[model samples]
Target: MRSVPRSAEFRNGGISFWFRELGCPERRAALLDTVDYDVCIVGGGYTGLWTAYYLQRADPGLRIALLESEFCGFGASGRNGGWLSAEFAGSRERYAQLHSKGAAIALQRALMNSVDEVIDTAGDEGIDADIVKGGMRLVATNPAQRSRLHAEVGYRQEWGFWPEDLHLLEHTDASRLHVDGTIAAAHSPHAARVQPAKLAVGLANVVEGLGVHLFEGSAVTEIRPGDGNARPAAVTEHGVVRADHVIRATEGYPVHPRGQGQEWQPARSSMIVTEPLTDDMWRHIGWEGREVLGDAAHAFVYAQRTADGRIAIGGSDAPFRTGPARDDNGATEPQTIAELWRGLARLFPIAAEVPIVHAWSGAVGVARDRCPSVDLDRDTGLGWAGGYAGSGVTAANLAGRTLRDLVLGHGTELTRLPWVGHQARAWRREPWRRIGPQLVNGLYRTADRRESRRVTRTSRFAGLAARMAGREPHEPGPGGNAPGSPDRPGAIGEASGAAGPE
Candidate 1:
């Protein structure tokens, strides 16, 4: 039997191991007085940072301001699993329903390209976030999972993904990774490993260097739309930022202006990073390629090999908090840490003895439908981009570019993407909001448990849970399962936004 390390054995909550490795960035001064700019972006996470980056690049003369409640990269931006994979954030069928199947395919293709876009931008900006485009591995350890894996690969092919984009690994090729109990695997070239905090910090610097006003510790209390000749404004504790366009880029930690908190539910994901593994441990693991790893299960895990020789993995074992409350200090529960550690051991037993150096938690915004959206209202000069679930790393970049197009009123292809202007219904209120995630996640956990016991087909419990969440059981969506399932194929085993382990 695997040994469970005592909670006291590991350090928890210094934000994350990534932040501790690089050290927290010096906090910028907060917005102390009213300011006016062409664009004011609320939130300093990737969505806001990317939006600022793209808008500044598009028009260097346009004055922009970015407001953050804490230091930049303090949220999920700094705490994500660091898989910059081209995972679609929402259901393709849903997107197709809004536009056309062709548009949905275009969105997938665009996201695939976004993986490279981020890498290229990082290179151009000289931001080294330990990126390795070695690709992603989705492993299936059981018969039920293996069946879904095959269906996922088939779905991708049917959706017109190139062989180089996605393909099933031969048994010999699958053996190369040496992950325990891997019956089958799928490979996608569009994923990359990154140090998420580094990227967030570096991008913040890049935008600041471009003359965008970045006000750290500036909490936006409310975002008020413009009226008559007035411009939209972001009201903060210290001051107000009035701008022609006010972009809400708060992602998982949204502070809705009108108490419409149910628009996006804040979900939490926890992670654990082991101390640097020894060379012998690496040999036993055989993850020389350093591909981002995931498993095909209802409740899944994502992992990456750090440049400093540690394994950082995360998942959504405990996915939500009641109401809109979230843990800002990155504290993770003991059971979550233990569960994540056990998952790591299950995948790579050789590292089971490695001490866990750090464990932390972060939030991701999940829309009711589990899809992401980028919307802009020209008349009110109000705009927003987020709800990436757990695929925000790359999706944020696309959102930033799309936001730029919308703000500039450019009839670009990005403006035509189906997710642009898409708005998911608000989540159910009250006890349901609190109980819904826990209940669904519990069902998923149960389904995963049953699947582990040699179940031959996808568990009905999973489908039932999906249905309860208002997702089609058999349609391809962000978190859907089954062949041509409602969930997006490439992200089947991916961590949800808060639980993003990539």
Candidate 2:
């Protein structure tokens, strides 16, 4: 049997470095008494909190209650890589197929606006999240990666992104941005670096201050829809929360309501953070721009320069659990931690000496179509949004706004976004659900290793793997994963749970 790696010497549960520095929020009282409200939100992450935030803003008199199994930011929202990016979690082609190409473009624009919306709201609401809009810097170290970056740029321009919005840089130019061994790079101003935990906690505080009742440590056990003249209710071990409308906002965590679990495949992503780097170390690694960084590998890696000078990096290196159960405490496998360290060293040779200070992991939801969705059943008064497929930061904010519009019965632009009302097919049950994703993960790992060994412009091995991984080759452009628009099909975490949440 393989021994777990020693790199897991630090904190391994889902408590992120950001949370370690920002400090988690104190647990609030559980729901011991039955209560009634205008709306009841189950989940205290960004989706739930943001929904409460906007709902209160839209109608101050509306009573909103948020329920959490743990303290706010205790799940993926607090442990995610701090990238507020416009990268949609699903294929653009899928969105176009559901709606229209114009609709897809509108969704992209809305996501971009959501990034700014988050930054602006944090400032206006006194939620200091160390927000830095340095944009995203995607680097390619191999020939295939270089070609893929170029293709992505062309697609973006064709999809209405200005040439300036997606600019490609040569190795010489890109090397100035701290990423070494880059053959090509691309920069998009539609992304930002943030302290995720700070943002989640700040939002929780903001919502609570807005008269939204937030009940932590209250694990919701069931959701019962009301019939005529009755209100929907969420049952907990403590009591039942009855409201006119019940919204399911628990992404990554288990959804208590029946039928909801069929739609989401929970996958865990692992992460590690290095001890504070010295000025000399930073000088050697000239990433002063602080743009959130990612590589062009099939097993993609994402990183951010923390406000405290630490390099926190993460990837989907762990196996998905057998059931809906999650690694709630943030602990990750020792091998996952080790691989992340190796990736960091490879990306920045100067960081080989940087000791790791913290390690953690978190789960993210994957819809059957690998896209985020928002919907409300007017008949049952039940609304839900999640399955972000690792891009949940800004997506959650957009989902919150969408839920608000849906609940208020407004046919606004937010409600018409391509993701709204899109019904993804449910994942296969049992061993198939568990085994299928594992096979894809194994194929991806094999392909990444084989491609590096061959050093070829394109890897047939990775292509075959992608096909087996359930992604169609015909996916479109704009986004790298667009169906049939293959400049670089491997640019995304195509494997079900191959990377960190947004």
Top candidate on TM-score is 1
Give me the overall lDDT of model 1.
0.80
Q: How would you encode candidate 2's per-residue C-alpha lDDT over 80-154 as one tens digit per residue?
A: 888888776666778888788898888878888998999999999999998899888887777766666677677
Q: What would the per-residue lDDT of candidate 1 be over residues 1-502, giving only the tens digit for each residue?
A: 4555533557788788889899999999999998899999999988899899998999999999999999988898898899898776777767777799899889989989888999999999999999999899999989888888887777766554778888899998987688998989999988888999999999999999999999998989898988768888999888999999999998888878554446777777878898889998888778889899888877778899999899888887454343564665888887788778878988998888888888888888777776788988887889998877777888898999999998888988898988988888887765766677677777777777888886777777777666766666334222221122224333465552344742
Predicted structure 2: lDDT: 0.75
The window of 10 residues in a row where model 2 has the poorest summed lDDT is 476-485
Best by lDDT, which number?
Answer: 1
What TM-score should be assigned to candidate 2? Answer: 0.93
Error of 2 at 250 (Å): 0.4
The TM-score values for the models, in the order shown, are: 0.94, 0.93
